[model samples]
Target: MFLQNVFTSYIFLVLGLFHVCHAQHITTSLEGRLAFPNKTPFNITTKITLNSGEYTTYSRKDGSFIIYDVPPGVHQLDIDSKAYHFGQIKIQLLEESMDSPKCLEYAYPGAPKRVVKYPLVIYAKGTYEYFETKKGVSIFGMLKNPMVLMMLFSVGMMVIMPKLMEGMDPEEKARMKQQMEAQKDPTQMFSQMFGELTGSSEDQTAAGTTRRERREQRRVKNQ
Candidate 1:
């Protein structure tokens, strides 16, 4: 009985030691990406704070960051970058293990909301139309002039000529042909065109004949 009691006491002592060790040692890990409001990845400096002290790290080019072996306790995590807004999180750590540690991740929310009493803006000053009571000094009068009419015609020709030339190119012709072939079915095209030319409803054509024409032809044949 004494030997069994001794072994039991030893077991309890060992268990207590194990618990104390687990409480003292902590494994902390950090993982997250730094990004701008647009969600584009960016490198940033990260700081982790514990009860004992604080440590700093930097994010990778891909914006991912990681830190390990932080003392087990409450911590404040901060991530900052010149190109993006800052991010922060609070974490608590308790024990240490060889197993994968929990990572505190962070991402910037975006530009902060603000109330602007008066947003500064600038407007260019110019008169849209200048008019004079003199014989030919009216805004509409200028458009009626031969010089202004010729200028408008020249501008229109310059804009349209390039597009017209592009359509005549062999490559454009082939591209148009391919597009037409992909979009068109001969039977459907024929049916649509015939319906339009004959002024018949699509449903009537689909049913094989117009009701009035069918009735008239049948009556004529019977007579």
Candidate 2:
């Protein structure tokens, strides 16, 4: 009976030591699953992380994952997926177990804590837009450029202005020549030329033509 009593005491002693060791080494795990709006092939890139990657893990074929040994503190949880985007989750953990994760977007004080359901099932809100949306070499874009507009205006003026001068009254033509010769600033001259071509300028010339050719001096408008 004494031998049996001693053996029982030894067993009890072992149990106590194990309990103490367990208490010392205890850690918490976070359980979660990734959900897709559509079927996506599981790849190495699909992963869950906590505290900006102090702890991270990948999902299984079924999209379920468990992040093990999460440090007991505040954490920002994120699911990194190239195929889709997920929402941020915030958590405050005690040493032994995980508390319900809150929606990081609404984690401000005085706001109601949005406690996420346990064994978290995070859903993909939208697919990642990885494709380039830019268009290639548009003609309208080139025509919109100021340099191109200026070049076109110069070419049209060089071809058309000679004919216009030929049909003008000698007094009006000589007055227009004097006004063009007086203009010294190239940028101001370019702006004035562009204004005249676009029909924004007044019909009266710089020399103030008193002739009936003042009506003809206005910009050639499109029918």
TM-scores for all predictions: 0.35, 0.45
* Deviation of model 1 at 185, angstroms: 96
For residues 105-218, could you state the per-residue lDDT of candidate 1 as single tens digits?
243344343221111111111222345545757889899899999999989976885687685866455444443554468775676567668877446534543565688999
lDDT tens digits by residue: candidate 2, 122-157:
777677787889889999999999999999998998
C-alpha local distance difference test of each model: 0.54, 0.72
Candidate 1: which stretches are off by over 4 Å?
1-4, 23-28, 43-53, 71-73, 80-85, 93-223
| Clashing pairs in model 2, backbone N/Cα/C closer than 3 A | none
Model 1 steric clash pairs: none
Q: Count clashes in each candidate, considering only residues at least 3 apart in sequence or on different chains.
A: 0, 0
Alpha-carbon runs more than 4 Å astray in model 2: 1-29, 36-44, 51-54, 68-75, 80-86, 92-115, 123-135, 158-163, 171-223
